[model samples]
Target: MSMEHHPHDVFFRSFFSHPDTMQALLQLLRYKQMVWQKDDGPLTPILPILFYHGPDGRISERFSQLFHPETPEHLRPQQVEFQAILYNLSSVHKDRLTAEKNLEFQAALLSLKYARDNMDLMIDELYRLARTGGTVFLSSKRFALVKLYLLHASSLTYDEIEQKIHTRITDPVIREDIMPSTAQMLKQEGRQEGRQEGRLETVHETVVRMLAEDIALDVIARVTGMTIEQIEAIRQQNDQTDQNQS
Candidate 1:
């Protein structure tokens, strides 16, 4: 398979691998490259972004490769061992960790939001953990709360998102950092509104062209996600506008 397909294959593997035995070391390679660039200290407990179908979850051999490593495969085995240390702490008490360590795990958990759809369990755990007043890396950043919504929002597609990694922000902390800029938020909102307006214009223009050609109103409605009544109304408006232009 192509390199593009490799990461997805690894995702599938993660879905099937043992929850505890799956190589945590491999994940660190990816985390270090992407999320954990700042810290290189001892291992800590972190909730990884687990991906799968439905709530029942699953186990597979593919789990070892879920993380894409920065270094060559030769160095990854050692990194994986380091990562295993974090996974082993999955059972540790969240309250027992230092403020910094708590934030590290929470940020990791937030990152996992992109890997799965429903994050009810993860969110609940975050709230539960935050009650201890532990620090999360994201907490230091602006718009961290908004980042949680984007991360945990069930409406977006993880598969489509993973593919758009180069163009989009996949790291929760990074997104949070950028999203807080008033200029950035306004620009994004404006772009979204523009897209919606463009779509509506396309629908209206298509209906007008079809009406001129004497196509059925129902056909225009079906193609444009509009109602038949709306199409007829547009047709009337078009006729008047055409008359004025003449």
Candidate 2:
């Protein structure tokens, strides 16, 4: 489920090709079937989701679609025992994606669409989504997850990702909690290198402290892996912010 999306050539079947994986999935299906029979109806079916964002590859909902079509009729019917709903994210255009009402789903589509190509565009898209969707959407757990995905998936460092949202995302929940909380989570996962702290304080405060220290933008960028633009923007935001007086 957590992948850059390339190896998933045939959805879960790609990774779950191992006999054990199918067996496990089948076991889950069996349990669900039992639950359905007892509590509800077998009409309820589980559909697996594949969120693919790779640059180049043919994508299709059915695993059978990947196979050559000129085969005999009987050989085709069983090519795939199951299929997943593929979110072919890379191919989706921003304009076409605008119709999506769920900001969370829209974020996934946009983030994956730009994971390899444009960090700035992705950042702008997130900002636009937040601005239009309101604070409730901005502060949702989905937004936080999308933010985390953008931070890790793109070349943009944590600080750079922070810069894109910290000042612009006026919600205290997102700025003060979700942002640093994600950083903390990444540190715990050992995904963030050089994350050391005697007492875990907010990364927002650290950025403010660095700005106040008159640290050069390039130096801050190097230390935090933030771009020079991000550092400068942070300086501008901090200068205008009342947090300095507090």
Candidate 2 per-residue C-alpha lDDT over 1-246 given as tens digits, one digit per residue, 9 for 90 to 100: 121223223122111111122333342333334334543322444455544565565455554555677878989866745566655556666797767888877876676578556877776677677667776876675665566556655667777777866656666654565467677656643445565563234344444554543322333343355675665566557645643574
Alpha-carbon local distance difference test for all models: 0.39, 0.54
TM-scores, all candidates, are 0.25, 0.48
Listed per model in order, the count of residue pairs whose N, CA or C atoms clash below 3 Å is 10, 0
Q: Which stretches of candidate 1 lie over 4 Å from their true place?
A: 1-100, 113-115, 134-139, 142-149, 152-191, 195-246
Winning candidate number (TM-score): 2
In terms of lDDT, the poorest run of 10 residues in model 1 is 1-10
lDDT of 1: 0.39
Query: Residue-wise lDDT of candidate 1 within 126-171, one digit each (tens)?
Result: 4444444434433543223233333323454433433343234444
